[model samples]
Target: MPLARTSDLLAAAVADRRGLPAFNVITLEHAEAIAAGAETADTPVILQISQNAVGFHGGRLLPLARACAEVAAAARVAVSLHLDHVEDADLLRAAPGAGFSSAMFDASHLPHDENVKATAEAAAWAHRHGLYLEAELGRVGGKDGEAPLSAHAPGARTDPAEAAGYVADTGVDALAVAVGSSHAMTTRTAALDHGLIGRLAAAVPVPLVLHGSSGVPDAELRGAVAAGMVKINIGTALNLAFTPAVRAHLAENPAVTDPRKYLDPARTAMAQTVAHLARVVAGGGQG
Candidate 1:
């Protein structure tokens, strides 16, 4: 199958009032596992390649992006390629040729005026190249060695009205809002502001995205979808599953020398996580 359109997947999820799970890919194993899991669950998924992942891959996007595209093409389920958390204009420009159906131009780290200016230009370019664009407004916590935001922090949460204005101003296809969850949290104890999500859903014209969703619990994830979070970005949870599997495999067989020996179990573990999360996002959490 060819790559599924991100716009179509998002539109379908929106119509069903469900959340779409997007997993970040750091390696070929990650892409393979995500595709396998999505196929196993028979759910549509977005395979995201973040800027950091590109940096890890010697600053080349096409090698990994094309690999993911091939993985998506071979998958039985609907799979879309996405450029995640992209701050580089050159990278965003390369997205179309790299087989990305959508891209998130992250300017949230910049001041509001600068964010708007940068994101608007990116959005326009994305539109010209026929890519669906997702943008962040407020700062989601725990990115780039930053401290996690307490629930009471004023800047931790996105203002509904401000988000709506930002969406309108930037002409983005979707809005990633900071509700309560923080990025890279290993524990699943992050409490989401469901009420704020609902308000943002109502206020913003575009689909609402929840970044740092790996920290959100199962029930909270379902609640977020119900409260109108359309896109759920998950990264750490896959690593949580992958890394432990690799360690456990090595512990059981310390003599193993081949990377494939451990990576196989690691991939399988991550696949199971993906399948379970797919069910959860599809409103069938218990299975």
Candidate 2:
């Protein structure tokens, strides 16, 4: 099948009260591994490329985007490409053309009114291009680089009423809310406020998205879906699986100068992790 749209995947998940796993892809291997995992689990998944990832690719996006689209197209299960946490207006505007079916135009760092205005403008552009737009209402708790996380104050949770109004005002297809999970967390110990999640789901018109979901435990993630989170974005967990595999392979075989020898094992590890996460997101046990 061709690449699926983010809206379509989320819509199905919402109807079934299931969570769609959205994995952040940093390399071609990541994209292939994620797609392989989704195929293994027989579940639909989202392949996300973050703005930070674009920077890592030398300020280029299309090359990786096209690769992800190819992966999605070849996958047995439905797969979509998403541009995640895109703050720059130009980058947001360019996403759909670069093969992203959806984009998150992050203006949550701006003042409320300014955020609304900026998100509305970006949403309009995305809609005009028939793309799904996701907007954040509050700081989703994590800085991109060495930037101080304190710059955005931790624990800034989203207000349900304000979230509804923001979604209404911006015409966004989804909302990424701050519900206690912090970005780039290496430990799966983040305690999400389930009550807040249910309230946000009731109040917000669109589907709710959970960013920094890699911090939340697997059981809690499943509970989050039952509480009405339709889209769960994960990053660090895949990295956690991938990096160790590469390290182990290199340590065991010092003579292995071939990149594929090490990278293949890393990709396999990532694929297994993705498959388990996919099952978890689908409300299945870690199979």
Candidate 3:
């Protein structure tokens, strides 16, 4: 199946009360691994890339974006390609050109009204290209994807009340809210506020998106689904799963110079993690 729009996937998850997994694709290898996992698991997934990842790839979005589109187009199962944590309007404009069906405008670093205005403008531009727009309400502070440690949660989490206005005023298809998750936590032990999740779900009219979900434990992930999060974004966990395998393969076999031999192990590990996440998010047994 070809890639579907993020809004379509979100709507389906919302109606079914199952949280959809939106996995970040950092490279062409990541995209292939994700498509393989989703096809094998029979789960609809979102293949996403951050602005940070874009810069890392080539200081431009075209390379990874094209990889995402091609991967999604050839995938056996449903896949939606999205650009995430994008604050630059020009980048958002160039995103659809590389075949993104949806994107998130993360203006949380700006002031409140500024964030709102920026989000609205992004929504307008995204709509012009018939793309779905996802915007974050309050700041969810974190280091960029390539950074070492993401900032802690004291001042970065979302405020549900403001989230409602952000969604309504910006005309975004989905809203990413910070209930309690923090970014770049290598471990899955971050605490979440179920009450806040429910409140934000009730307050915001659009389907709720949970960012920084890599730090959230399995139980909390299920609780987030119960609390009405339709789309959940995860990255670091897969990185953890993939990186160790690649490192171990390289360490164990120093003579292996071919990238494929080591990368396949990493890809397999990431596929297993994706399967686990899909099942946990859906509250169902893996296929």
Candidate 4:
């Protein structure tokens, strides 16, 4: 199968009022497992590679991106490749050429005006290269153990009016709004603002995305989707499944020096998690 267009998948999900799961790819096994999971669930999925993950792999994007593309192409289900949290212009430009259908140009760390300016430029360049662009607003926090916003922090949640204006100014295809979910949360206890999600959905012109969704509980995810979240980005949950399995494998078999022996179980665990989450997202938490 060829790589599916991110826009097409998103459009279909939007029409169906379902959430599309976009899982992060940190390693080749992650890509393989995601594809396998989507295949198992008989649904389309997006495999995303973030800038920080590229940094972890020696600042190279093509190697992993191509690997993900190849894995997606071989999968039984429709799978798209996306570059996530891309702040570097060079890396952003590299996406389309490296087999990505879409890219998230992150400028959320900047002030509103600056974020609009930078994201607008990136979106223009991405459009020119035939890539669907995603941008973030209201600065969802807590990446790599950074402190997340308090419940009452100023500008912590996305204002519908501001988000609409930002999307209009930036010309992004999708918007990741801050609605109380934080990135890299190990516990699935994060509460989403469903009313705010509905408001943002009604206000924004394009599809809505939920980042830091790994922290969100199943019922909260269903509520978010029902409220209008189309794209759900999940990363930490895969890590949570993978790392513990590897640790347990090592604990049980102390002399197992073969990487395959441990990595097999880790990949299996991630695949199971992806399958379940895909069902949960597609079925609106009915999984």
Candidate 5:
């Protein structure tokens, strides 16, 4: 299959009343692992490259984006390349040309009106280029104990009415709403408000996206999807699987210093994690 558009993936998931698991890709191995996992599960998945990941590669994005596109093209199941959490308008502008099928233009850190204006501009540009655009409405908890950007301090749940307004204002293809998940959480204990998810899904015109999904437990993830989340974004869980595999491989074979030796196992571990998450997103968790 060719690289599927992110809009198509989300649309399919919405039609099926299931969630699409979107894995964050940090390296070539990560992209490969995500593709392999989607193939193994016989399901479509989204390959997301974050701004942080781009920075980690020293601002080079095209190479990795092309690699992800190529991987998607060659995969048996559909795969889509998405630029995630992009704050720079320039980067967002460049994404469609650089082979990204979709982007999350994050202006959630800005004031509400500014976020709306910026996201609206991004949505216009994305639409012009035939790319899908996702925008965060309320702040899904950021890392490092940063307060969420809502009237409520800690438990900043997205208001259903506000979500509808935001979507109407910004015209985003998808809306990431803050329910209860926090980003970069290593523990899978985040309690999501499924009612809020349902409300947002009812009120918002676009598909509801669940960011910081790595912090959500498998059962809770299933519930979120059942409640109407179409796109589920995961990052930390892959890293959790990948880093430990590399460490274990290195510890076991101290004499071997080959990057491929350790990385291969790490990739496999992450692939397994992705497959499991994909299955969960596909409503297999209910079984």
Candidate 6:
């Protein structure tokens, strides 16, 4: 299949009451690896590129976006190409031109009305290009570099009432709510409020997205999905899986400095993580 729209992928996940796994793509390897994982799981998945990741590579979104689109197109299962946690309006606007099918315009650092107005502009731009837009409400605590951080607990929580208003104002296809999951947690111990998840899901008109999910344990991840988290965004877990493998490979073979050997194993490890999460989010355990 070709690249998928976020609304299409998320609607399927919501209708089936399953969580859609949206993994961050930091490199071509990451994109290919996640694609392989979805192929293994036989389910639809999303490949996301955060603004931080784009900055890491010197702001070349076009090359990576095209590569991710290729990986999604080649995957056996459906794949959606998404830009995640983008706070910069210019950067968010660039995604549709770069061939992204979906995006999250994150303006959570701004005050409520500004966040809504900024995100609405982004949503309108995306909608104009036939791209699906996801918006953030209430700052989710944590940092994927510049992602607005909150001092409050990861589960410090967003008011579902305010969340609904944000959605209505922005007309976003999906909403990422703050219900206590923080970003870049490698410990998998971050707490999530299932009650908040349910409340936000019922209150918002669009699908509910869970950011900072990499910190949430597998069991808790399952519970979050069951609680109405339709789109679960993960990045740290894949980084954890791949980084040590790459380091070990480089350490062992100092003489053999070809990038492929190390990169290949790291890619495989990330693919495995994706497969693991996909199965959980797809609600296929005990099968």
**Model 3: residues >4 Å from true position, as ranges?**
139-155
lDDT (CA) for every model shown? 0.89, 0.87, 0.81, 0.89, 0.87, 0.83
- TM-score-wise, the better of 3 and 4 is 4
Model 2, which residues run further than 4 Å from truth? 139-153
* Model 5, runs deviating above 4 Å: 139-154, 285-287
Candidate 1: C-alpha lDDT: 0.89
lDDT of 5 by residue, 105-183 (tens): 9888776777889889989989999989988877533447654473212467888988888889888899888889878
Query: Candidate 5: lDDT over CA atoms?
Result: 0.87
State which candidate, 3 or 4, has the greater lDDT. 4
How far residue 6's Cα lies from its native spot in candidate 5, in Å, is: 0.9
Task: Summing lDDT over every window of 10 consecutive residues in candidate 3, give the lowest-scoring window.
Answer: 145-154
Each prediction's TM-score versus the true structure: 0.94, 0.94, 0.92, 0.94, 0.94, 0.92
lDDT of 2 at 199: 97
Compose the digit string of candidate 1's lDDT tens values, residues 248-273. Answer: 99999999999999999999999999
Please give the lDDT score at residue 256 for candidate 1: 99
Candidate 4 segments exceeding 4 Å error: 139-155
Off by over 4 Å in 1: 139-155
Error of 6 at 6 (Å): 1.6
lDDT of 2 by residue, 1-287 (tens): 79999999999998888999999999999999999999888899999999999999998989999999998999999999999989887888788789888998888766666788998999888989998998887642334532212111347678788788888888999998878888889999988889999999999989998888888898889889889889999999999999999999999998999999999999999999999999999876676
Q: 197 in model 1: Cα distance from truth in Å?
A: 0.6
Per-residue C-alpha lDDT of model 4 across residues 58-126, encoded as one tens digit per residue: 999988998998999999989999999998999998899998989999887765667779999999999
The window of 10 residues in a row where model 6 has the poorest summed lDDT is 146-155
